[model samples]
Target chain A: DAGVTQSPTHLIKTRGQQVTLRCSPKSGHDTVSWYQQALGQGPQFIFQYYEEEERQRGNFPDRFSGHQFPNYSSELNVNALLLGDSALYLCASSFRQGAVSSYNSPLHFGNGTRLTVT
Target chain B: QQQVKQSPQSLIVQKGGISIINCAYENTAFDYFPWYQQFPGKGPALLIAIRPDVSEKKEGRFTISFNKSAKQFSLHIMDSQPGDSATYFCAAPYFNKFYFGSGTKLNVKP
Candidate 1:
């Protein structure tokens, strides 16, 4: 089966511009999460989407938001981007057996979208 | 505060040698721990994981050792090879969220 897929493998935008990145979870997964990975650093959790609503979010500001559609695809939107927003945007998918039980499902990741803010 | 902390920012090992990476967590509520491997321009892939109930788990050349009392864990790679070179991250899940370490860059030379 195809793994998690993300579109626009790479993107470039200037400061104050809005950018939207897309992701399609693995075939059997129902939950999608987004993370930001900077050069030589581990990924930081951005937020997670389930049941078409945002279930949990990390330390990101209001400028960063996401949406999950009925088909389980997800989109991450960053408004008024800044130079520090340049990083690899990763999308991870997992099967949700239950709200808490699903934590056992190992996360499958996409190749990720490289976003560069100029 | 960073929930999970990993040490040895980078490491170099010869082929057929053993490479070990360590991590510690402050959240006692975290019960599941996982390690991920990533290469340049690629996403981090799950390598191995362990739960607090189990002190150790092994898969192929990778092994995870957990010390519940110390709140520390480690990944050991045996018979390392050049292709094993990659960045490694240790993570823990809490309240449906995951906390990742800064990552360890391992270079196995042949």
Candidate 2:
């Protein structure tokens, strides 16, 4: 079973530019959630996608958007980025139903895309 | 607002000692609590977890002690090893969304 995978292990973008990060959820998983981890900080929830639709979102602004493809893959897009947007973007996949009770089940994380917005 | 708060920005311990990190949550509705461990240049991985209904859950050297009334929980590593060093985060899932603590950096010296 392949774990979550992210593309563009490292990314560089200029201010006012747009960047897109990709993720492939674990096999047999339906829910994909995105998080942003800044330097010396914990991962912050960005948003979640379920059934090819966005299910919930965090405190991020409109500039941060995401899409869940029919195949359960996801893309996180940031428009008009700022320097503060520089962080490690992570993609986590989990089974939406009966997830918490499964002892062997936990959020499968990707290596992440280290986004550097200058 | 940050719903979950963790303590000890960083910790250093000798090998064979125990390392403990604590976290508290403000939301009572949170049912599932999980701990994630992250290393340099890597994403956070699930280390251990517990539910509010349960007071304690153990997995090998890792244990999660949860206090429902206090809304507090902690991760304990026994006989800590240098490989155990990493930043740990405590999180809770609420309303289909997940919230995480600030994080604690743990370093074990051999």
| Number of the predicted model whose DockQ against the real structure is largest | 1
Across B8-95, the per-residue lDDT of candidate 2 in tens digits comes to 8899999999999999899998768999999998888988888788999999999999988888999999999999999999898886
* Model 1 pairs in collision: none
Q: Cα deviation of B107 in candidate 1 (Å)?
A: 0.3
- Per-model CA lDDT versus the true structure: 0.94, 0.90
Tell the DockQ for candidate 1: 0.74
Q: Write the per-residue lDDT of candidate 2 for residues A1-118, one digit (tens) a residue.
A: 7889999999999999999999999999888999998999888889989888887899999999999998999999999999999999999998876454333456789989999988
Query: Can you write out model 1's per-residue Cα lDDT over A35-56, one digit (the tens) per residue?
Result: 9999999999999998999988
The per-model DockQ list reads 0.74, 0.59
User: What is the per-residue lDDT of model 1 for residues B32-64, given as tens digits with 9 covering 90 to 100?
Assistant: 999999999889999999988999999999999
